[model samples]
Target: MASSSSLLSEEQFLCPICLDVFTRPVSTPCGHNFCMSCITSYWDNASFSQCPVCKEQFQRRPDLKVNTFISELASQLVSLQTSYCDHSRVLVLFCRDDNTLLCDVCSSSCHARHNVVPVQRAYERMKDELENTEAKVQQMIQERFHKVQSMTESVKQTAERQADGFVSDMQREIKELQRTAVKLRELKQTTDQLRFLQSYSSTSLLPHTMDLSTVSANKHLEMQHFGKSLRKSASQLRVSLDEMNTEISRFSGGTAESDAATLRYMQQYEVNIVLDPDSAHPMLCLSNDGKQVRYNMGAGMWAGQFLNPNMFTSHLAVLGRRGFSSGRFYFEVCTGQKTEWCVGVATASIQRRGPLVRSSCCGLWAIWFLIDKFETFICPGVPVHMGKVGRVGVFVDYDKGEISFYDVENATPIYSFTECSFTEELFPYFNPCDNEFGSNLEPLTIVPVCHVE
Candidate 1:
């Protein structure tokens, strides 16, 4: 008769190699078992390692994966047999001859001639190991799922933010353009009123006149000479209106911001604008025309960290000077001996930011015209308006009597700061195209902040 445990003992366990019940467990292509992750990694680094099974030579080792399913199944069966035999209340057997073990007296007797000892003590020693391993697998899966789900959600949020930013940028720009239009109407009214007054300036101011310097000191007498002051006020008003108009136009015609892009490092978009006298350094030459920021001589005393007697620069506002493109804008600044000297927009200039700049510099900003060309200067301490790049737009501050740079079409303000010292001479400079001035050595550097769609 066949023994009850004969089949179980013979068919239960598999060779760590071959992955089947131990039937001639010869070594395989690897010294390790049928599951070969270990031996493969070992031989992979060795110069020449023969296969443990057939002693075959391999130039390079291939990737290997363990058949963990078969290993665990066999291991579990062995474990079950370890405690199944009905030998005693608590059975354990150790083979002193081979330093091996058996779970019950039956196992020891079957493989007799080997010294035996109880196995209950050994089994108890490592009872929780298998359960802990299974728990770790579950935990690993959970962690992976969490990472994937959170990553997807974060991506969606970032995309939505970029979209909202673009829309807000667009709406603000449109409002600026409207304000510019309104200001233009007001400016036209004010101009007509003042132009008429200019025509009759001699008659109006003939009754009373006072020097501008004296007017500064004597407030009442200056007020009495309203006629003379009327023409001057009108001229100043015109200049202010023109500055606003220019800013509005510039912001009213700008490009859109780029798509949401992840920038892990500053190297992606950040660029160093350095100047060097030698080796094709960017120069601050005179730009024959106007309409852009360029390099020009400092006529008056202005002190800052950078105070080179013949070096401080301005902007060229011309359309097609030697250093400028016909329609595309560029920089005409200076570079030192490998020294960084940059002049990019504080932020992107694509969206319509008339309102933003207007709010910061003086409020009531607008883009009075299309294809914004106004030179809006931000007051000191005021922040710059953010926007995309390349879009046309403008910004205006009618209430504050200030103008700010903006994308004329999109309406994203390019400038946002407060400037208390900017004078009328710094406004448009007569478009700079009609009259030539300044060198265009290193032109206005325009690094794109957004996609140039």
Candidate 2:
């Protein structure tokens, strides 16, 4: 019976506004009890000063005095209820390893070997972190608000400028229309005068038709001027847009590093090109993996190896199984070790049986590797002296009509064939030229491009 009455007494000390025990208990003029902070906040928002529970009015706002007795009683109740370790001891320590609040009993038991710290220290650390996070959040919100305001202002300015330009264009058109109307009116007056004169006197004073070529010439001139102005404005706008894009790229990362970075990025689309033995010459021997090919000396001894119509009779070359008719693609070939080789793209309709003409008109665009120099097959072959390079990188942009070759080892550009009009699908062509007495017998290997970093 005594414990039940004590619970009811504890409820009376709780602030009705907060539903919690009062920190600084206070009394109002109407004899209502509440926490000082809670009552002050309520009065600040209230339309009139009155008791919240009874609706009894006060003539004037009264000064609130702290009820010291209630405050002491609330504190004692809170301490007794929240005491750690079965309410016998206060939680004054924190176990770092266990990540738990600890009293004396808890510290000596499960957390005896763990690192311990004062609870107050942990509370201070957490409080500091929370405050810093709150400050950063507020700063972010402010920055976004400013950005929105700037964007709105910019939109408004653009709208006004466009409206002004529209008005100016409309006015110019109206002036042109007015000038044309005046010319028409003058011509009508001249025709009326000529008709009146011809009614009485039969003399050919005016021409059979009105000569409006002068007026037409003037109108044409006006139209040309308008077109010029529009073109000028568009060109200026394009220049400004380009400038803004450059500024934006400065803030972001700039374009890929000239050659090396571009090659690295292109490696994502590196394709697996397998050599087709059916399209290979009898003198050429392909590796089992199909990534490499070499010229065999046995072709000279046998003279006739395989009599197939699909085999290359003259050119010692092979075509890749995969073909590309559109878009972009890249592949690499190790041509440094080999003294003689030919690598490039070839059209599907190229003759496979008869004597092959290695020319652009004959559907072959390749860089022929000789003993000491590189020569591109484009009619009268052009010699390219890019020094001795090991690996060669080939990049083909079919839609752009460009085929470029690069020295992968030195990161140097070798040559590029531009403005090529391809009619059929192109296949990767490899020709490890005939073994010249075993001197140029090194195989041309296709190197797979992969991510380096």
Candidate 3:
């Protein structure tokens, strides 16, 4: 037996295939060394026989022989063994740096944000994003796979035109390409799940807080007193809750306390807008609450302008998470002389501060904070997806060359901007344009049914 240190140059003796000292060396017909399985798999399906290493033609399989000298030497090179530290072989460390989790203490100390998890359940809740990313990867891969196979078939068709009998060969390759497409899709699906590691490892839900320093100190103290008075009625509020539950059950049970008359949901405001440079009167309409307004522009009231340099026509969004806490704000409109101007989002109160007067070639129009600030600017050629708040309507002042709103949300074109003085309205509106047009004012109405999400 050769001494471990006297085994000659380890680098020279290494097999290129496995990047290790050969375990069982077997010389091929052309003198290439391979582990038995590696070489056999290489030649198993090939019809034309040739040495994979040297490309030497072999008429038939040669007598195989095992070289025992190298095999015995490989057995003597024992595998390495190790053990983990007693304190933290299976620790879940929190990283202070990234607020993420680390399995080792070394990582926990450096990453400030990392929170150590001693239990597997720490990551259990965070697995959804990982799974979602995995799913997205699979979906994107499937899309790409179809693209690749389509391209492959196209190329095959072109190739078959020049080569005889290639059509049949191309048809055979088609099936193989489809299988490859599926494999590619699956690869992407799993690879995208890596982001899941950081999400669960470092997630922390901190409590929200706000200081009551917004209003004047005197007003703030007054509000605190008012808040205390409100809290005093907490017991009374509990009693009211009981009454409300009784009323709800009574209504559901088809029993009336006194008289049973159902009331329709009411609109707080009605809306209408027009760009009449001359004289135009604001129309009054009855709201759902049976209240009337002179000229209330609906949520569909929107204007198209070059808000961005590229002019992406984003919709008039009512702010607030789910618009839960939104109130009315002011808006300012700035028209362009060259038909290239910028419209930015500002509190609708900002527009009200200025005198509502008609200015130069630059035109500005705004509705005071009567309702939530509607982000009603539109781009020449841009499509938008107004999420959640389904289909909206918009009125177009075709003659005065301005878009207006007459009806309320989910409006099915209650009015149109007729030649003399007509208007239209809809809700949750977004208009997309492909190219710019001078004075090409337009309106957008999304289909309510299409709001799948």
Best by TM-score: 2
Better of 2 and 3 by TM-score: 2
Clashes of each: 104, 0, 52
Positional deviation of residue 176's Cα in model 2 after best superposition, in angstroms: 36
- Give the C-alpha lDDT of model 2: 0.62
Return whichever of 1 and 3 wins on TM-score: 1
The TM-scores of all predictions, comma-separated, are 0.19, 0.44, 0.18
Worst 10 residues of 3 by lDDT: 257-266
Residue 327 Cα positional deviation in candidate 3, in Å, after optimal superposition: 52
Candidate 1 vs candidate 3: the lDDT winner is 1
Question: What overall lDDT, based on C-alpha atoms, would model 1 receive against the true structure?
Answer: 0.32
Q: Which stretches of candidate 2 lie over 4 Å from their true place?
A: 1-222, 225-257, 300-307, 379-381, 436-438, 450-453
Give the range of the ten consecutive residues with the poorest summed lDDT in model 1.
258-267
Q: Tens-digit lDDT track for model 3 on 1-453?
A: 984445645564566556667644666777777654445456666776667667897886553444556555544432100112244343344343454444475554554355545334444444554455445433433433343333333332222222222223332333333333332322222211222333333222111212212312232232223333322233334343333322321122221211111000011121322221111111112223321112223323234323222221232221111110132111112111111111212222212221323221112221211011232232222222221121222322222332322212222111211122212221111112211434322222222221100
Error of 3 at 83 (Å): 12
TM-score of 2: 0.44
Question: Which lDDT value does model 3 have at 261?
Answer: 12
